[model samples]
Target: MRHVISLLIENESGALSRVSGLFSARGYNIESLTVAPTEDLSMSRMTIVTTGSDDIIEQITKQLNKLVEVVKVVDISEAAHIERELMLVKVRATGKDREEIKRTADIFRAHIIDVTDASYVVELTGNQGKLDAFIGAIDPALILETVRSGVCGIGRGDRVLKV
Candidate 1:
């Protein structure tokens, strides 16, 4: 099964390394990771996406708690949550291809952030599946480059991850 684990940890050097190292040492594969400083400034929120069995997920939670720098860890996947990913794709654009790409971008509600005589850079944000669908809709030969920001997630309603 897939899980979205959120962690509140000290915003200190090596904190990220240690957390990631733990997963690596245990042979757990992290599909995506996003970390950023929180409002407190002294702490950071990290969202990690991984897949494992119930036993494996339980073990992961316990091991994460063992880290001294970790303030709290929650498997947001257990509750109502929201997740998003950002992707930027540069595509070859010329003549009819340019018009078609523009129409596709509009249909996806993506922005044409940059444009030139030979290419167009489209910025898109949505769930992984939505992003994948956009890519699938485009011709492979037209794709020049792609950059994706890993998943970022948060719990819904009054459910907040705090110290």
Candidate 2:
């Protein structure tokens, strides 16, 4: 099953490498990873998306705790959580196709952040499905490029990953 693991780690060089190395050493696959400095300058928050059975996830969590830089680890996917991903798509937009693209973007509540005579860069933020649907709505031939920020997730309500 897919698991979203959140971690609080020391905001120091090599911290990320070590964490990723652990997963690589174990031959596990990481679907997505997002890390950034937290409110506390000394620490960072890392969100990793991976798929494994319950036992495998539990084992991975335990191994993560052994890392010197890791202060906290939580499988936020175990309960109610909120997840979002950002996607920027550059599409050919001209003639009749331009209006159709605009309509599609509006329907998806996405913004046209950049535009030129022949192309538009649409910025969108939402869960994976929503972003995927937007891409699916557009003609593949018109898609010039696409970039996505991997899943960033946090537990809902009282659940929190912090020092």
Candidate 3:
């Protein structure tokens, strides 16, 4: 099964490296990884996506929690949360293709952030599936170059996961 591991860690240098090394040492694969400074710049959060058996997932969480630099670790895959990712998609579209591109973007609610004679840069933020569908719809007429921000999530309702 695929799992999402959300980690809150000290914003000090080498901290991310240590956490990443743990996965590397165990030969686990990271499908997606994103790190950003939290509201408190003294800390940062990382969301890592990996696939493994339940037992292996449990072990990964336990070991990650034990790391000194990790202030909090949560297996958000099992939590009730609102997860989002941001993507910037640059699509190569010329005059004839521009209309089609705009229509496609409207369907996805993606906004055109930049445009040139040769391309349109669209910014999209949503769950993974929405992004995938948006890209699929425009791919035929436009060549794509993409940059994606890994998952950022928040818990649901009155419950909160605090560091």
Candidate 4:
């Protein structure tokens, strides 16, 4: 099973390293990780995506808690949650392809943030599926570059991950 684990940790050097080390030592793999300082700059919130069995997921959470810098760990996947990722895709747009690319971006609710004579930079935000679909919809040869922000999620409704 794939799990989305959210953590509130001290914002200091080595905190992320320690967390990643624990996973490396345990031979668990991180599919995606996104971390940034919270409103309180002294702390950071991290969303980690990993695949494992239920028991392994539990163990990962337990070990994360054992770290001194780790303040809180929540398996957001265990509850109702909203997941989102951002992607900036640059595609070749020239001649007849220009109109098609613009139309496709509009259909996907993506914004053409930048445009040059031969390229368009599109900014999109959605779940992984939507991002993948957008890439799939474009001609592979037209794709110039892609930058992605990994999954960042939070519990839905009234649930919150408070440190």
- How accurate locally, in lDDT, is each candidate? 0.96, 0.96, 0.86, 0.96
State which candidate, 3 or 4, has the greater lDDT: 4
Give the least accurate 10-residue stretch of model 3, judged by summed lDDT.
135-144
lDDT of 3 by residue, 43-113 (tens): 99899988999999999999999999899988887878888999998999787788888888888889999
lDDT for 74 in candidate 1 is 97
Q: What is the lDDT of residue 155 in candidate 4?
A: 97
Ten contiguous residues minimizing lDDT sum, candidate 1: 27-36
- Measured on C-alpha atoms, candidate 4 has an lDDT of 0.96
Better of 3 and 4 by TM-score: 4
* Cα error, candidate 3, residue 145 (Å): 1.2
Q: Comparing candidate 2 with candidate 3, which one achieves the higher TM-score? A: 2
Off by over 4 Å in 2: none
Ranking by lDDT: 1, 4, 2, 3
lDDT of 4 by residue, 127-151 (tens): 9999999999999999999999999
lDDT digits (tens) for residues 94-161 of candidate 1: 99999999999999999999999999999999999999999999999999999999999999999999
**Candidate 2 residue pairs in clash (backbone atoms < 3 Å):** none
lDDT of 2 by residue, 2-110 (tens): 9999999999999999999999999877999999999899999999999998889999999999999999999999999999999999999999999999999999999
